[model samples]
Target: MKMKKFLAVISAALLVISTLSACSMSGSVEVETEFKVEEVTEKEGTTTVAGKTFVVKTNDGSGLNLRSGAGTEYDVITTIADGHTVQIINQQGSWANVTYGTYTGWVNMDYLNETTTVAPIVETTAPSGATSSPENPDTQSGGYLYSYAGFNPAEITINDSSWNLTLLNRHYTLPEGYVPQLSEAVRGSGVYLDYRVAPHYQEMYDAALQDGITLTPNSGYRSYQTQKTNFENKINYYVSQGYDRVTATQNASRVVLLPGTSEHNAGFAMDIGWVTEDFENSPAFAWLMENAQDYGFILRYPESEDKQAITEIIYEPWHWRYVGVDAAKEIKASGQVLEEYLGVR
Candidate 1:
């Protein structure tokens, strides 16, 4: 009987060992199977376009302007800045069709670069001792560090806000570091316009669009330094045409404004669509003539005014300036230049 009991105890010991081994194997498999290794493939936060990625690169403050069509003449949709990612749907000679956030437009190919992968821009806290507007620090604040920044007349009033009616011309200049409340009219035009004037321009643009007319603001805000560069380029072009230096300088001044004196520096002026005399004959011009004043703007220089005697600048239908609505109406009624309306001339 004692021998029988010993054999039975051995049998139980063998069964216990076998059960423990099976449990260990099952545990091992569970641990190994539960952990998964995933592959890191695409760049994080990068936009995918046409199965390829392109990044925006703009060193100048001028953000890449996205247009309804391929050319500058097309309606501006928005402006995008450096480090932004876009997907290119199609490419023409100099423009690329792209879509960003439910808006699609053409961007200048010169500003786009194909890249392996890139992430969207992340905002960092402002540095010490610098306060930026909570609204649009990039546009409204001064210290535009780059050449693409816009300027506001330094002496613009706070007591009786000029509301974009302030006069700036050859006789006046915006003070250095005068910053206007700027907002982008489109996503990527990088045109930091006066906050007050941008809305009016858009309303006018929309109004014109309803009538099948397209009026695009090709040039809006310009820094004094930019104006200087344009002025010098104009002088150089005239000199290349065999004009004497003195004659070229004077001629350049008549057309290309002296750097400090251009109305463009004020951020209130806009050069729309075209710069040639032929612009006056377009349907858009006729529309502007009959209706622009209602939107609080005036043709800064009209062909009817004696260019030499009245404004000293050549007549240009493309240039328009913002005055207040009431003032614009009166000026339109009286047929006076801003100089005559304000009695500055």
Candidate 2:
């Protein structure tokens, strides 16, 4: 009886040892189980991770776009209205993965303001000296003002349609939902421009063709969202080349203007032929240098250090802007950029 009791005790000790060995062999089981739980929660349109609340703040009052992925190339899930709050789950560079109501997506962190509590709306009358009227509303008293100060985004909202020479750099932006009356600049080529610019561009194209040079319109009339996608793509390209998010954005802006600040977004610009410096050496460019102003077009970005300083844009030989025959002639004669001719610089 004593021997049998000792054998039973030894068997129990061996069973405990085997259980520990099994656990050691599958050490990641607990971690895998926990990860699966989080994945299930995410699939259910909820997150188990703790998050902080942030409010959407934008200059144009257009709110912010929530995307399926962290980049603008991703599909838009929805547009979160300005002043709406979102829960930030994680951050990747300048983008934040967030949840707003039942939807979860990513948004540009630049447009978010952190707050522990929602701020109350305040009402106040305009200042005593401020003057606004139907004839000259406050937003359109004159042409939208452009600033020379560097790299400010969406400072002014353009409302006046008569302001064809309206300056749109980083400082001035079009109103939200603003889309100009558009027509195909080159029929069947799929390029479009504002109605006011189409006839002039067609005339210019015909004239170039008469001179045995074909000026092909490659791009024109980009929507605000399209511009955003383009800008973000350029930024991504730079980031892929070892640039950090901040530097990537800065570099991208030099080539692709921020969403609302682009002339393409305004529908008053066109990119012709090859969009490269090599266009500067083309016969088509030489023809344009001599006669584009006659048809109300001007080389929007010229190769001059002084102009680049004021315009804050690199020389793009193929980009042209339509600014009426008179304005174009004056600009060409004065050897000045649009900013300088308009006395804005």
Candidate 3:
């Protein structure tokens, strides 16, 4: 399944590169060197050419992509908005290395306008000496905007698109009807993860197995109703212990999420090992803590007061969550919870 997805994505990207490379770059050079372009389609916002400056000219709502390499197959650095000026670094076939703010990546030359000078971005200060408001986050100092899709707290909600890197925590809850894809996590565990997360989980499990570690997926996605019942049952037990119903509910919530709030419903969080503190002493837990980030998984709750302060959850060494590989690497290196890394906390 992963191979098919990989092939499909790669094949489509290769097609785009093939088409682009076939296009001619024969426009008259305004500078000493000739950069490829069959014709200058738009001349209005062009700043500089001949490998010095090029303006993005997608000419539509869809912006041009700046990629890691000179091909569509490379990862996108960011999207270059139409008419936005850029500083060039180098040029390869059908692509040019360009600088967009702090980002440096390759962009398709077909969607560029050649120019003679790099235009300055004029920062507009607030009129009447009024301070900037939330209505325009860009007006704040050190707030130059880029097209990178950063973390969004709104995606943590029940109606969120599951494909997003949603931060599931106490504040975010899954919808009652939110049943994401489920696939068997292992051969015999009968456990399953969200289809979006299953492959990465499998990859991590396999790697851990190779290292003689028994990293198990004890639990995965749970239905909202199931979590609600579990919370209620825990609440009932606490109430039977001579606590008031409200107090019991609150105590119950400390351990179990009140239904939709459980990260299990998100299908990315999983309980591994034996679900005990002793698991932290196991070689499996040690291996996972060190290597899971390679597979896009992170120990969701570590035994750290600082992390617990931000996550508002007790340390659970057995709990792991799947963010993306990039985010996971950053989180592991920084030792921050999902909330802090995402700027949500």
Candidate 4:
């Protein structure tokens, strides 16, 4: 009986050891299975969360314009070269918010082709003459800085005879011999303007007269030749003041636009009261600032430094452009310069 009990106890001990070993093996398998599943899940999440990459594809090779806003009507932040890679951040209609090098802005998705290959991160510095600040950073709507380097006006010439909304600036100019139909801006004032602008100017002049202000049209409707003479005279005046030819020309551009670049050449802009800064102090300017938008006129060059940077022109309180009543009101309400409103700068 003692021998049988010993054998039975040995058998029970073996059974207990086997059961514990099985449980330990099962736990080990479960832990290994869970780690494999977690590793796979993490790898999948990383791929899924990463932004898709794209390459710029342009047929003209002029590069794609990265804009401050989603549409072409928005200000262009920079130009991305063809075949450059960008990572899309978001999409709106046909536009995609993208990051190229150190720059971030919106680009047309139609010009981008999806790429599975990831681009290596590259840091870049802003172009010389670009304005940047810590608060504004360097490459976005709130921070992107525009420089006047390497700009060729001939590349952006506009030949269209759009009386109201045609853009003329250092970056954009009228074609040679471009002219508009003209009439007197104010009866007997001898200042001519585009026929579309004359009626509005007459109404604005009449309204100002009702308010006891004489809103005289001092200058308007300059032909290309007239604009050229005016620009040369300005350059000569600056040269007489001891400036080099290059510097004088630059300085002259701030006051008198270069030939076809002047709004006066387009026959839709008018200079009222005086063309100097003293015009800002006059009641005529104040009245125009308050009521000109109602008659489809807007102060062309504003006094803001940002606006000056965009326009590349000095503040001119007396200069006004006719953009139709709706556009005038919108531009005034937005407090943006014509370049920003029209998105051509």
Best-fitting candidate, measured by TM-score?
2
Q: Cα deviation in Å at residue 193, candidate 1?
A: 1.9
Off by over 4 Å in 1: 1-160, 186-190, 305-308
Report every candidate's CA lDDT.
0.65, 0.72, 0.65, 0.71
What would the TM-scores of all predictions be? 0.53, 0.57, 0.53, 0.55
- Candidate 1 lDDT over residue span 81-172, tens digit each: 56666766556656766644323467887888888874321111223443222233234445522112232323434224664566665545
Which run of 10 residues does model 2 get worst, by summed lDDT?
118-127
For candidate 3, what is the lDDT? Answer: 0.65
Q: Residue 338's C-alpha lDDT in candidate 3?
A: 82
- Write model 2 residue lDDT over 1-345, tens digit each, in one string: 999999998997898678767887988344222212234323332333226678889999977987868898986645676877877656776787765542356899899988796332111122343222232222332343211112445556555665579888866777647788899997786778988899889999988898899988867887887777666665454444455544555656676787788889888998886554667998999999999999999999888898888887888998999888999999999999988887884
Tens-place lDDT digits, model 4, residues 89-145: 556666776655423567888898888878653222223443322232123242112
- For model 4, where is the 10-residue window of minimal lDDT? 142-151
Best candidate according to lDDT: 2
Clashes of 1: 11
Residues 221-295 of candidate 3 have per-residue lDDT tens digits of: 777765655555554444444555445455555556555666788787877854445568889888987898899
- Which whole-number lDDT from 0 to 100 does residue 144 have in model 2? 30
